[model samples]
Target chain A: MNALWKVARFTATDIFRSKWLPVYTVFFFLIAEGLFRFSGDSGQALVSLTNITILLIPAASIIYGALYFYGAREFIELLLAQPVGRKPLFTGLFSGIAGALGGGFLIGTGLPCLLHGTADDRITILAILSIGVMLTLIFVALALLVAVRSDEKVRGVGICLGLWLAFAILYDGLIWLVLALFADYPLERAAIVMTTLNPIDLGRVGIMLRLDIAALMGYTGAVFEQFFGSRVGFTLTSGAMLAWIVAPFMLALRSFSRKDF
Target chain B: MPPHDMGRHCSSLEMMSAAAGQILRLLLLFSICFACMRTSAVHAAEVRVGNGVDFAAAVAKAAAGDRIIVPNGVHTAIDVKIDKPLEITGQAGATLDGKGKSQILIISAGNVVIRGLTFIRSGMSYVSDNAAIKATGISDLKIENCSFRDNFFGIYLAKSSNCIVRNCSFKASGRLESSSGNGIHQWYCRNSVIENNTIAGHRDGIYLEFSRNAIIRGNKSLNNIRYGLHFMFSDSCAYRDNLFQENGAGVAVMYSKFITMTGNIFRQNWGPAAYGLLLKEIADSHIERNRIEGNTTGLYADGCNRNTIHFNTFHRNGWGVKIYANSSQNNFKDNNFLSNTFAVSTNSSSLQTNVFDANYWSEYTGYDLNRDGFGDAAHHPVRLFTILIERQPTSLILLRSLFIDLLDAAERALPVLTPQTLADAHPRMKPKQ
Candidate 1:
């Protein structure tokens, strides 16, 4: 555990000094402030900021994770020559990347929402921010999994971008098609399960349920409310998010341990 | 139906018994006073009922145009059938208890007046629809300044014409929809006036069925189990300056023609199938100057035609207006749509039938270079995301997301996905004050 912390601290410092996280923070700050000024309502601003988070957070995390992993190849090789175990090195790298991204997102978007939003809106904003953080971690782990499997840098980046595209855009399209095709059947439970398969959808739905916009959703929104409105549903969704985070990281760790220096 | 008729018959019998008791008491009081007042100048025609008086017997013995005065006390439910023009007035604190078995007062004669009475505990049978005050086949009747509590129906006008019900309050705690009746129920009545009444906790606050030429104004109807004010097959009616709040679903105007609804307020009617006002199968109506706020849907119209909606404000609702495919010829002009999730949503892509012009939409962003108080470009109220979510409601999880916004913006720039003709040609530059 001590060695893991040491390696994590070292990698976090290296990533922090590169100044890429500042760029991410500034990007979010400008978007949030601009939305706040234009929309003229705190709730509307939160809604727009939530949209930005859902789209850009996953893409940014995946691309940044793959690039940072490839850029730190020499450092990783040097660490492999040390007395450090492979497991700790992989854990340190994953935590360092996820922490930096999550921290940047919080400071950038979350702070503005808290400052501008009313007291009643605090819980909803915090819930949305936490979902953003979870998406960051899940996508970073998936990116690492793609990085460890592929040998060439071009192949790794392609796979990372493809994964992001598939999860963020294509998955919803496929769900729409399936729902339309088999609309005769009772596919509510199946639809919910499909959403959990995509971490982005899970995060989106998790925050929407909190926003109380389910009344506009018609029937399916009612179904989701009945499922996710309860404590059991909340626990199940949170567990699914945790599984999404851990499963990819474990797979990436196994492959990294087996790879040749 | 036979069972319902039987229940009505039984309730009438109970009312007769109560009237008989009041009459017996009145006779005893008259006998005691007969010995003291032997002046022969006493007007024996005028029947006065004080404490422990037989009110039913007095009504039976009186002729037309006689006045019956009831002093302050508790009286039995008097179910006297009036065949003459009479006035029944109660003093302060006069109460009539129905004992939860029969109708409190039933008037079948014309030119009757009943005022200043508290009626309570009418029978609760769904078959009978027992009411505190039931007027049938009576013309030119006046019922005012009455309070009703825990009755199956508060004031019922059946097959009556030219009646006035004003300045009354009704309250009923109904646990189920099927078992409860409306506060002021009018069936087959014509030219009646219902105004300045407050009603709560009934199936419907004020219900009109097959009634025509009725005027409903300045009433507060709130927290009812169903609609605040519901109209069905009621034509040529006008309701103005009424307040409907927190009902199951706000006022529903259906199957009506030539109706005028103006200056009403609808608020806080939030539910899955709830709306501020529902206009179904209505035609040639005018809905103007209404305020609808904090509802699931501000106005939901289906199968409506040729209605004019003007100067209404829809604020902070889930959807400002959801018009189904069958509706047409509805003109929405000079209205304000503010802070709703979707300004207008329709099932079909055709916008040729309805007109949306000169309306102020908060989401409109076109320039007004001509300075005529109208935008230079047309404003499209329907979004592609709205159409998608209408098809698949679960897509609402992507509400306000960037991808949806991008798609909306792209669709706005190029009229490819959304309905091309569903644009307001004369969108107002500023909201109507």
Candidate 2:
């Protein structure tokens, strides 16, 4: 436990001093503040910020995680030679990156919403931040998973980008095609299940379940409305998001422990 | 179809009383009271009847143009059929209890006036539209300052003309749409004025079928199971300064032509298939200066044509305007679209001429370099993401995702996917006031 904490502290300080994390924090601050100013309404600003958060957080976390893990390959190997266990080292690294990104997200988005948002907007901002943190964890885990599985730097980065592309873009497009093709049939449940398969989409849903509930209630199917209306659906959707955060990290943790350094 | 704007329409209606035309209402009230006093003083004999006296017998003895005044009490007035022209006025706190039976009062005579009465519990019937007051084949009927509670239908007017319903309120208790009736149910009626009425918890607040040249003004219709103000096959009618809020299916203006709707508010009518205002097979209509807010879909046009939707404000709705491919030649101008989930989404993949021009959209991020009060960039109201959501309803879960934003940005940059005809060519830099 002490070694894990020491490693986490070390990696955290190193990433924090590198100037990228602070820039990331500032980047979100500017966005949230700018949206609030430009729209002149906290509700609408939160909506716009939600869009930016759901879209940018996953990409930034994934890319940053992949690049960081690949760049710190020699450092990781040197640490393996130390007295620390492999599990502690991997867990520590994961916790360090996740905490920094999550902290960056919560503070970056939360402060602005605190400054400009209404009481309701503050609630939505909390939901958004929670989704943002979970999204950061999931994407970072996926990135680390890929980085650990593959030895070549280019191959690992390429696979990470492809995974991002698939999760972010192609999955939605496929769902669109299927829905268009089978427009007659009831695809509400099928579509929801498909969305749950992608972590980014999952995170997006988690946020929208809070934000776009009014609009979602407008959907003709009872399934969509029930999803928004019922407590059971909310719990399940949140459970799925938690599973998303856990599943990838577990897989990455196993691979990190097994890798013969 | 539940209404889209059901979120805050009731609040908007409540807000409307304080927001607009308070002074006008006061002046109008004074003039109206003065006119009523003058008209009543010159009329014929007055017969006082209430509290266990046979109301129908009193009506039978009263001569034409006589004023049968019902005194303040809970009078058992059930199935009173009046074939003679008389003025039946209720004194303060006059109540008519129907005993949960058939129609309370049936007026088949012309030139009749029913005023200032409280009506309750006209029985439910499957085959008939049972009402508190059922008037048939009459002309010059005036109903004013009456309130109906727990009735199937408040005032049922059939084959009537030159009628006026003013300052009345209708409240129903039925929860199911199948069993409920309307507030002011008009059928085959012409040249009628329905003004300053409030209706709630009915199937429809104000329902007009085949009723022509009617004016519905300053009515507050809310929480109906079906619609607030439903105009079916009603032509040459105008409804102004009305508020519709939180209705079940929302307000529908269907199979109507040559209608004018202005200064009205359609708010909070939210449901799965809800809309603030729905135009189905409607043509040659003018909807202007109205507020449509917080609905599922603000104004849905299906098979509507040649309509002028101008100077309206659509705010915080699911979709500001949803047009079907079949709708044509409708013009939307000088409107403000603010904070809607989607400004305009259409199933019209290929463009038909439904002009969206000079509207202010909050989603538009274009510069106005020319400074003509219009953005330099042509604002396409329909986004690629909207198209996806339209085609694939389940894809709504992906709202506000990074990929959806990219697709929208790409569509704006390239103009490839979104329909070409839905663009606001002269998009306003500021909201049209």
Best by TM-score: 2
Stretches > 4 Å off in candidate 2: A1-10, A40-44, A70-89, A118-123, A150-154, A180-185, A218-221, B1-46, B50-52, B61-72, B84-93, B110-112, B347-351, B384-418
- Candidate 1: which docking quality band? incorrect
In Å, residue B361's CA in model 1 sits off its true spot by 3.3
What lDDT does candidate 2 reach at residue A96?
A: 85
Against the true structure, what is each candidate's TM-score? 0.81, 0.86
> What are the RMSD figures for all models against the true structure?
11.2, 11.6
Write model 2 residue lDDT over B1-433, tens digit each, in one string: 1234443465777556554456456556775888644333244798779454578878887877788999888888788988877899999999988887888999998888999999999988888888999999999899999999999888999999999999999999788987889999999999999999999999999999999999999999999999998989999999999999999978999999999999999998877888899999999999999999888889999999999999999887888899999999999999999888888988866967999999998888889997999999888899998888776687676677666777788887887768987789989988887
Q: TM-score of the candidate numbered 2?
A: 0.86
lDDT at position B184, candidate 2: 95
Candidate 1 residue lDDT tens string, A1-261: 777888778777777889998888888888887877767556556666777788899999999999889988898999899999999999999999999889989898876786677886787788888999999999999989988888689999999999888888777777777877886787778888898788898888877775545254345667777787779988999999999999999999999999997
Which digits, one per residue and each the tens of the lDDT, describe model 2 over residues A1-261? 988898888777878999878988988988988898888445567778877777688888888888889888898999999888988888888888878888887888788878888776566788888888988988888888888888888998888888878887888778777777888898888887787677777767766655665577675534665763478877777788788778888898898888987
Model 1: native contacts recovered, as a fraction: 0.20
